[model samples]
Target: MKLKTIIVEDEVLGQKALAGILKDFCPETIDLADITGTVSGAVESILKLKPQLVFLDIKLGPNTMGAFDILKSLPRIDFSIVFTTSSELPENILKALNKYGAKKYLLKPMDIDEVVDAVDCVIAECGHDGTLLNIDQIKNIVQEASQQHVTKKVSVPVKSGIEFYPIDEIIMLRSGLNNTYLFHTDGMTIKSSKNLKFFEKQIIPEGFIKVSRSYIINPTHVYKYSKEDGGTIFLTNGCTASLSGKYADVFFKMLNSST
Candidate 1:
């Protein structure tokens, strides 16, 4: 079933680009309900149409808070949101969007394939009926946006698209044949085409240590360390990873610093 969708972008070019993409590639999944630029216009159209999804821009005109204001004005947020913006979203705002039922954001200069994929994802999540988030949930999201806490996350590229995971939830990563396997706290393993080196750069800043050339481990998920067979570390998932002697000192130091 096609999702009843609205576009709330300020720029005329952005509106055309997204609308054209949707009309061209996402006709099967999206039913364009309304397109508006201002907060008041968006709110009005949203109320009148009761769309299942909205493509919102973070900055509306000179008001940086316009998009948020439209959300706050709503009686309840029962639909899904996909934010469209040029700048990297603040961590707090990202967290708020996630809480508000937005799993992804489209960067400006939106790609057609990506736009179609995004709409498909939202349709899968929203369904024809749409997911219902209460007013209190909306308020909490707004409150979170007002806060300054920056949650660190890792964006993993997959065949389907991108997956965002909290850094702390990753147990460890093991490299094999130019690909990387990510083990999560939930016992989920994601095999990515991205090489280990690619992920190393993304996670190292969050305290994940490269214990060996083939393995990177989040010390927080280290269940036990063993000196047997040179050195080895057991993860919470009971998977053991080699701990190269060269990195042992640095790894221990990192663990010490974290504690």
Candidate 2:
């Protein structure tokens, strides 16, 4: 069966990029339902889309309170959640995604093949053994994956100085060759010498994530999440950003790792 999905991201270019990638990659497997980039947008989109999966970002704009507020406001939930973003402050949000239990996740800046493999793995596991990825198991996978791949981390030396932001420290890595920007829990951004791909190698196998084509965020930073075009995220640094459709799978695994 095709996966019914929703994308909730705040960035515009990021939004289009998601659609484009899906078009080329998982066209038949994904059925795009809704898209949003703000907390309000997320709520509205969810009401309409009612997707089974959501790609949510951590930074929702200037503040993350709205994202949390929206999640609390939901009267009921029937879908699985996937968070995306660049800060590592909200442990509660991660716990909530597993509140009902579901799949582990798919990291970002992810190749279409990897994503398809993860989803295929999930479905196949379900079909073969009726065993699925629970929140806790997903957590272990992320931790193990993160540890196995983190043999070498490239220091992000840009901007102010040759600051070293560990892969785990980064909450969000912007798209393109603009150098990966790490969004710390304190809300400080650390620039990298290379691009997100440098870090992707480390996180994609285990933890860390890319939520959109232009942005990659850490799973640890997610506060709250929803399914919508503007998937809302409340961060520890009091920041919020909408998760877009382009990054749906990336968001899922990031949150799965933390939750």
Candidate 3:
């Protein structure tokens, strides 16, 4: 089936560029319905056209409000969004991935192969389903993403290859000499070859905060925070870690922001 798609981009060049890419690479799978430059215009086009997919640019206008505002106001979300952005910062990338629950994020000055892959992934995932997506599912995805909640599972590298762990089952991470150990809520620990910095970048968007130089703890699993011993955090799984005085202020700020 030819997927109906719309491009919600503010830049004229970006719109043309993406349109050209779709025409060249995704001719068979995608049918471009319309293109709009603003959030209101995009929303109206989306509702009227009822497209199966959307290529949405992240920075629409008004620094504070963007595509997400448009998404939040929509009565129903039946199409999948592939967010496009120019920012390569980790925090921005994380917000796009975790908050928007975007099917794919294409960095600006779009790559043809990446665009093709995103389109292919969407097409493959929507195969034979009457509706590509629905309101309730989108709402849940947005909520979960906003909370930095994990998707169902996470892959952790092991000696052999990789092991899948339930995101919720992870409690904390502690750095050792050269490796980081993942502490699970169920009294199980897994050693990862990557250092704390690697895991920090990977999981920071997934609700894990680095409270110290050697520890990254999942706030959901945190049982108590005691300031007595230079700041000690107790997890629900009977694990404890000390928070560095240097990171305490920022850590609390992040905690408050998440809440």
lDDT of each: 0.83, 0.58, 0.76
Tell me model 3's lDDT, rounded to 2 decimals. 0.76
A best-first ranking of the candidates according to their lDDT comes to 1, 3, 2
Put down candidate 1 lDDT per residue, 194-230, tens digits, no spaces. 7787676567867788999999998888888888999
lDDT of 3 at 258: 65
Candidate 3: where are CA atoms >4 Å away? 89-101, 127-259
Candidate 2 on 1-259: residue-level lDDT in tens? 6768877777776667666666677777678787788888788877777776666664677756444444544555555555544433223344444443434433344345545654555445434433334445445534443344332343454656444445565566665565666677567866675576656665565465566656665567777776655777666666556677777776776667566
> 1 or 3: which has the higher lDDT?
1
TM-score of each candidate structure, all chains considered together: 0.58, 0.45, 0.50
* Model 1 pairs whose backbones collide: none
- Residue 24, candidate 3: alpha-carbon lDDT: 90
lDDT of 2: 0.58
* Candidate whose TM-score is highest: 1
Clashes of each: 0, 35, 0
Rank all candidate structures by their TM-score, best first, as comma-separated numbers: 1, 3, 2
For model 3 the local lDDT of residue 93 reads 40
Error of 3 at 111 (Å): 0.3
